[model samples]
Target: MTLETKSLSKMDFVYWTSLVSGGVAGLVVDIVLFPIDTIKTRLQSERGFIRSGGFRGIYKGLAPAAAGSAPTAALFFCTYDGLKSYLGQFCSKTQQPYVHMISAASAEIVACLIRVPVEIAKQRRQVISLRYSTSLEIWLHALKTEGIRRGLYRGFGTTVMREVPFSFIQFPLWEYFKQNWTAVTGTALTPFTVAICGAIAGGIAAGLTTPLDVAKTRIMLADENVSKLGVSRILHGIYRDQGIKGVFAGFVPRVLWITLGGAIFFGFYDLTARLLSSDQAK
Candidate 1:
């Protein structure tokens, strides 16, 4: 069913639809592009762009990512759309950009709770030369040795820092593109247009935030005995050690991954949401 745009209540069906659509989109995108993600992670890891492995075990941590992708994306879009609808009542159209920024940042915070642990597992598995057999094994081993907070949720704060600004920049830009596309073309924004906008937004966001991502990855992958380092310290260390380029270690692979992944993700999300709404109307 088509969602009534005027509805601001949390109980509205659109919120749930957004969750389902976002989840399905995320699942599809992560699964299809997971190998690229593996490569990107390896590039970003301490290995520093070395040829770790060819296509031998590219799908190492696909399970944990597949498990978490849906829920994380679902929570993100659900919170985003819900907040936008709720805030729309009080804010003028001129303030919609701020609303989008707030909604995206808030959504990322909630999504990170699920995302960080899965990411820790996924990245560790990706970097390892030896196969872990299953994502469960990696998680269990990490939990047993490093414990939950230090092991699984090690870079939670840095991740949030990376993600919040990423979303803040991305969603507003995505929305702006969508609005302008409609205004300029005098046609409704299609799934293709949404995908294009999402790609542009995701690529820019991912590129600009690579330094924070590098910090987050290093923190998460660090040995437990290593002293804890904040984002600033990690970034400074990267700069001091490898110069300016070290901070953007995985920029190329990451940009490629996020750009294509974002296109596929928002494409499917918009398509699924539109189909669901159409079916409901019928």
Candidate 2:
């Protein structure tokens, strides 16, 4: 096949492959790491961690997370791969980083449509005071009281803010890491290598964006009156009251959770994609 033909085929493959692999990866990582994520969310909540259930009910939000993780991840990879392929045609090799950033950011925006709702439900349930009997109940309650935009889609803007910059940083760095490793070794990239790169990139991104993340969690779990203060005001409030420390609440767990999550997610995704590709080649 010609290079163009090969590219098209790759994009075509991504449609199914990304869905399957991303779903599997997302489910595994999210479920396996639920407790850590709970801890992180509680830390970032406006309520103190001790007051937000502390170590109790770590899996309270598992239902929403389990339900949303697969679709959100699948959508992200499909959009990301498709965009990367289409946009790459218009950019020089040297400009590929920008293409990756754009692709990742776009994918994140699309994924956030699902992710924000999941987050709203999940984070709220993670806190004891905000606990709902079920994910569906959480949604119903939010919709009833706050409506869609303020309730179901609470924290959408802050989520996009946190996620887009995260993708911009993480995806480019991941691509760069993989590229350099392949160039230096003159070998095909492996799932393990991809995972290592993902871990590093995710850790850096998660650490740097902790404040935005804190803001997102707070917004999602906040009462209507408090949430109306908006991301900027909430951020300022946190900074004013607690200084830099409060802004970066949950920094440790956030970094650790994402680092491990990235490794598992990308590792499984690469492995599953390769398996599917090999099967197709037969």
Candidate 3:
């Protein structure tokens, strides 16, 4: 049996396209829904939902998140697309879904390297009383005080626990929905369709992972005392203190943020890809 092979160089277009598109999509999503995310973080914080300063500083950490969103998203899609393309050469059509899953997982892991530090800065800034003016200041202070591993990447494990499964649940579901939507409607999958599918997948994934998210948030934003506690211990504390509902604090806003953000991220990504490819063809 002969397998058709194309030059890997052909994928250069996909690499650049995914990078640019993912960046744009991520930036838009992060900036637009930043307020919701602020609220969610506040809800998940150890301080509970009654922090001072009111809604005035809802966009407090928007800078770091917005700045990081582009690069993080670009890295994820670029890695995901590259891996998927490479894997496709070896895997049969029947095995494509598994390949996608593996690719997405790989992408998420790599993306986390960039994402974790950004999250550390963002979450810490969010819970504070706006003492720091910029994400850079927050990061520098944390680095000086807490050191790298403990400071900038405090919740790395918990974040991975939340995000990896989120990718696992989200990407496959998005693919499945897109395929089925195309089959049923007899129409090509458009950005709108991709957005809808992404929204559903993201919402489900975010909702399911809320407990892990709460754990991650607590770990990242924890003070010296709480920071000493292990993830299991912290989770046990949440359960012990506030019950099951506490474990899922900020579920509604998280779902809303992720769902809408997913829609915008995916929709813009697809739209950008289509436009880029069209330009290349012309």
Candidate 4:
């Protein structure tokens, strides 16, 4: 609840710590779990799971995902930590959850600038790997033919819609879990404990937001014309066509993937930040 908001200097140790640690966490978790993500995408694809190359070529989207994950996460934590510190100065301890929520929402907005394009290319490749030999090929095809908005950033709005609510749920709970653990143990939580908190929070958030995620995935994998129908229309169509089960496509895989990813990401982030902070103190 307390933050030392001395100033907004990017040269500060905490800034670099957040940037590097978040990057490392994001890159490692995303790459390790890329296959699970591929499965989730195929399951959510309009082409149907088996027809969309089910289990074949699971690493189809690794290139763009790897390239984008680090920076996007770096940007997220940088924005999140900085804003949390800056904004913490304006609120009471009881209001800290709102602080976390606002910071995370802002961070997600910033992160999505890069995440959306990578997601578009990544999901597309995951579902249609045979149609394109490389991730770059998909990116080029989208941009060249569809232009930026409808192509590379095809699901930008829905992604923000999904990610914002996800952050709203996950971050507040992650912080709350850490606070509770620290209070109960009379000591700060270790990276592993923090990770457990993250896994719990992330799984809950992912499960709750599966429908929004399904909409984002559907929009991305849908034809260019379908992209224009928007999130509401897409959701309606999915419900009308496939029923309630259709709206929650890939729910299990999504929750599973995110639970594992949250542990890796938050645990490594804490470890990396602690290491950097220790080195700075030394």
Tens digits of lDDT, candidate 3, 214-269: 98988887775787777788888999999998989999999999999989999999
TM-score of each: 0.92, 0.95, 0.94, 0.94
- Please give the clash total of every predicted structure, in order: 1, 0, 0, 0
Give the range of the ten consecutive residues with the poorest summed lDDT in model 2. Answer: 222-231
Off by over 4 Å in 4: 1-11, 185-188
Off by over 4 Å in 3: 1-6, 52-54
Give the TM-score ranking, best first: 2, 4, 3, 1
Per-residue CA lDDT of candidate 1, range 165-274, in tens? 99988899999998899888888899999999999999999999989888888887777654278889888888998988889987988889999998999899999999
Q: Write the per-residue lDDT of candidate 4 for residues 1-282, one digit (tens) a residue.
A: 225454434337667988999999999999999999999999888889999988998998899999999999999999999899889989999999999999999999999999999898788788863477777888888889999888888889899999999999999999999989977878779999999999999999999999999999988887778888878898899999999889999999999999999999999999999898888778
Candidate 2 local distance difference test against the native: 0.91
Flag regions of model 2 displaced more than 4 Å. 1-10, 185-188
